[model samples]
Target: MFLKGKTALVTGSTSGIGLAYAKALAAEGANIVINGFGDADDIEAERKALETLNGAKAIYSDADLTKPEKIEEMMKQAADEFGGVDILINNAGTQHVDPVEEFPVEKWDLIIALNLSAAFHTTRLAVPYMKEKGWGRIIATASAHSKAASPFKTAYVTAKHGIAGFTKTIALELAQHGITANAISPGYVWTPLVENQIPDTMKARNMSREDVIEKVLLEGQPTKEFVTPEQVAAIALFLCRDEAAQVTGANWSVDGGWTAE
Candidate 1:
């Protein structure tokens, strides 16, 4: 496998898109560090599964991404175990829906922390190791919201937009170092993150669950299909390949034409 012998660290990987990322990397034989919160037994099962997939090691880190100290500890653990993160996927995120003025102050802070700031913290800690090795891949899971706006998702949109910008800036800074940085902007992935947001959106827009899925969620995309986590993870794997070496600073849209409108 092209990624054999490399090490990858995927954040928010206990389930959903994050888990998909870890699995894709493991299939290519990359030692993996999966981070997030979930049931203890289920997580251990996935960790063991990853090792089986790669015939390499896989670790789980329950680092609270919002806390800088915990992030540092997680990075340290990766360094100690696998030298450092050769590929870093900052895919952890949360969402809340409400009018801008009526949005919860704490929710806004939490969304920003988990979605945007955590990526920043992880990138900073991982970059030095990448630079020293003269090779690295940094991919962030931005959203179609990063390019377009939807009602009642101010904080999520803002954080994703910030991720887009962050990817561009880092790409330039690391361009000469054989390290590529990019953002994968998917339209509406049918994950827990998106599924859980429907209720808040239903409440915000006074719509039923069916209406939220049909009119509110799928209305923007011509395809009218939810993007799969595997699809998004596939793009991330492509970014780690040598063929994608010149593909830095770009935001790839896997949104089924959601942004085409």
Candidate 2:
């Protein structure tokens, strides 16, 4: 119960890595506010799953994080329900794939809004409450692309790089306020988004899934395996600990040595 009295807001938590983080925090006794843009029924189901976890109270706030106004409202809803946010996981994001020359302007804009600007919005809104309380943890789900890059994902790579810079600046500004801002960069995590991308990549290359995984995704990774959400969540939980007060403005990578080379 490291987070026994903390209230955590995990955006895009209805499924995937976000959901895993919510569960991990709940296991440590953090009250969870799950955020996602989805059907009400799906949201309710996710809320129920979180609630079923012992020592955790789960609530849902459906908001499209790409919109600033909606994100503000979601923060208010979380604060209202959970008292105040002690931990914020900025996990809501999307990716678009296209050659730079052919990339749609609208897609680029949407990627920035969701993956980068959403973090800015949430941090700005949550900072005041955190400052008032004298303690807070802000974790952004950046990507290995933040440091490296892959083809056909120009917008995602750009947004992730922006997030790294954003996290560092916020960490410096909020350090004196007992708030820590950091980013977790995961490589080849086997989430739904990644799974979807696998098929698309396969289609593009006219290769089998196995061939794509072995020749493409694992080509740069030393371990040649997907990093699990649990692994990433464990690091996230550690960053929220009182012991990690001095560990701000860092990008913790769970990349299976993808960036090591």
Candidate 3:
């Protein structure tokens, strides 16, 4: 058990990649703190599901990442339950797609708040505890868009790029304290947030779903497949292990060769 006796706080983990990460960590013997912004029913359901996995003590903290106060509160709750966070996965993010000329300011602001600024708030709160313990892992869920630009996603790209930069800088600053920060840049993972956009793109381009996947989404990928959430979670689980202690300030890509070209 690589993470035995450790505690991990994974944000936006009620479903999709975040949920997968929480489960992976728990399976490694880490007590899990799952955070999500959703109704009580759905949150509780995820909480129960995680608890049943290998006797892991899974708890839910419903915090709106857009709010700094709420982020602090969530950190406090996790610390109270698990003594301190050994791992912090900044995985909560929202996306918006629109042409630059017509993009809504509100949407841009919201994406930046949740994707980029929220990490800042959460990391700030988590670091002191980590420094005191002299050991921690901070993983930010960046995207391939962080390194490469795409059409109609200015705010999303900007936030992801900011995450990469933020993680790198913090990794340097926190190295002496036995804390490491890294970013995972995934290509295309089929999550509800992404699946919802498929129809919108199809309508806008007047193409079938197959056409969208073949000609637009997976067109540049050498593997011609969407990266799975479980695959990404596996990499995340590895990074949280003690053997990966020397690996910091890195932006790892699990993009199915999407960015290799």
Candidate 4:
């Protein structure tokens, strides 16, 4: 329980990688603030479960992250409840698949606001608390798209690329504060969201299930495997360790060598 008494705030944490990040931190005894939209019952269940991970406190924040004022309120709640976030994981994101010409302008704005700008809001709000303590961890769930691009995903790609640069800049600024800022870039992570798309993809392309997964999905992943949420969370956990104090401004790739090409 190296993180006992610390607090972690994870955006988009109701499920998938975000939830995994929360669970990992909770296991190490960190108080938790989970943010995202989900079934109320499910969110509460997860929140209750987190508190039991190591007898730490856990709360839920349904803050609409695209709104800066809501982000501020959420941060204030964290401060009021647990002395502010010691670890901030900017993981809330959404995806829209379409050519740039056909992409909805509203979606482009939302992607930029949620995936990119929300990180800035959370980081800016949490930095003061961290600076006061002289210790903190900031991790962003950037994607393989952050390093390599794919067609029909202009907004997502743009936002992720922005995140890579944002992570680097903040890392340099916080380096002397005993804080580490890093981004984790994972490729084709296996989650309910990814799993749900498989059936549709298989039917659309007249491909077998295995073909959809291997050829269509894992095409760029040299290992031909879906990176698990736990794997990405492990890297986040490592970044919070005292040993990683100097490991800032890095884009840690858990992408099965997708960007190695």
Candidate 5:
């Protein structure tokens, strides 16, 4: 295994795309630190399942991504437990859909802190170790909103756009250091987050659930199919390959042509 002795820290990884990333990495033989909130039993199950993959070690962190101190502590724990992080995926995020003027200030701040700034914190702490090791991968779960905007998602859009820029800056800064940085932008990912947003979207647009799913959620996606978490995970796996060493400083879109228009 190419990553037999490596370690990965993936935020928001108790479920969905983030979990997929963790599993994919563990399959390649990387120890995993899965972070997020969920039922204690369920989280423990996921953590145990990850450890089963290729017999990799796996741990769980309940760190609050919105808080820099906790993020630092989480990174320290990973470094202490696994020697240091070799793969860092900043995937924790949240969304609020009120109109720009009506968006709560607290919501905007929380979204920015979790979605964009958390990556900064993790990267800053993890980079020194990566630099010393002379290799690393930093991937962020940005969204199609990073490139194209939709109405009523001002905070999410802003945060994702910020991630795009941040990824590029990190890539350039580490270009000669054997470290790669990138963001994966997915559109209409079929996850609990999207499923849960349907009712709110229906209420906001005064439409039925079906209408919200088709006309609101899938409207921008020409494929009219939700991007699967596994599909995005495959791309993340590819980026860590030796063949992908030059693929940094890029925003890889798994949006099914949402931004092609």
Candidate 6:
């Protein structure tokens, strides 16, 4: 219960990697504030589950990440309820994959707003409170694309690369305040969303299931295995510990050697 009195706000936590982060922090006895869009019943279930797991308060916000006003309202709610955030995980993101020439301008705007600008807004709001307390953790979910480029994902790659830079800048600014800021870069994370895409990819490519998994899905990942959300969550939790006080300003890659190459 090292984090018994801490409060963690995880964006896009209704499912996938974000949900995994909420659960991992909740297991360590941190109060949870989760946000994202999903079924009402499902969201409540996750909120209740987190509360039950650690006997800590858990709340959900349906804040639209693309809008700063909604993000402000969400942060205000967290402050009113929990006295302010102690750990902030900016993980809400959306992707639109198309060739640069055919990319939709609206999609580019949306992706930048959610994946990059939202983190900036949340960090600015969270930092004042963290500085007042002299301790905090700020973690952003970047991607292998942050370090390496791939075709047809111009917006995603740009936003992730921006996140890496944002993390480093803030880490240096808050270095002596007992706060640490870092980005976790995962490659080809295996989620239900990713799973659902495989069949369509196989059909489009006319490849066998194994070929799709290896040649298409896990091609850039040297391990030939997709990174798990739980694994990323574990690393995030580790960054919250006293042992990780000096681990700021780093983009920790959990990308199965994708970025290593």
Q: TM-score of every model?
A: 0.99, 0.95, 0.96, 0.95, 0.98, 0.95
* lDDT (Cα atoms) of all candidates against the true structure: 0.95, 0.89, 0.89, 0.93, 0.93, 0.92
Clashes of 4: 0
lDDT of 6 at 152: 64
Candidate 3, number of clashes: 0
- Residue pair clashes in candidate 5: none
Candidate 1 versus the native: TM-score? 0.99
The sequence of per-residue lDDT tens digits that candidate 4 reaches over residues 1-70 is: 9999999999999999999999999999999999999899999999999988899999999999999999
lDDT of 3 by residue, 1-261 (tens): 677788899998988899999989988888999988667898888788877777768888888888888888999999899898989999999887777888899999999999999999989888998999899999999999889998878999999999999999999999899999999999889898778777766865788998988887888778989999999999898898778999999999999898889
lDDT for residue 215 in candidate 5, whole number 0-100: 91
Query: Tens digits of per-residue lDDT for model 6 on 147-193?
Result: 98876678989999999999999999999999999999999887765
TM-score of 6: 0.95
Sort the predicted structures by lDDT, highest score first: 1, 4, 5, 6, 3, 2
Question: 1-261 in candidate 5: lDDT tens per residue?
Answer: 678999999999999999999999999999999999999999999999988879999999999999999998999899889889989999998887877788899999999999999999999999999999999999999999999998888889999999999999999999999999999999999888788777767766789999998898899999999999999999999998889999999999999899999
Superior by lDDT: candidate 1 or candidate 5: 1
Please count the clashing residue pairs in each candidate, in the order shown: 0, 0, 0, 0, 0, 0
Worst 10-residue lDDT window for candidate 1 reads 51-60
The residue pairs in collision within model 1 are: none
Mind sharing the TM-score for model 5?
0.98
In model 5, which regions exceed 4 Å deviation?
A: none
Model 2 global lDDT (CA atoms, 0 to 1): 0.89
lDDT of 6: 0.92
Cα deviation of 75, candidate 6, in Å: 0.3
Q: How high is the lDDT of residue 194 in model 5?
A: 85
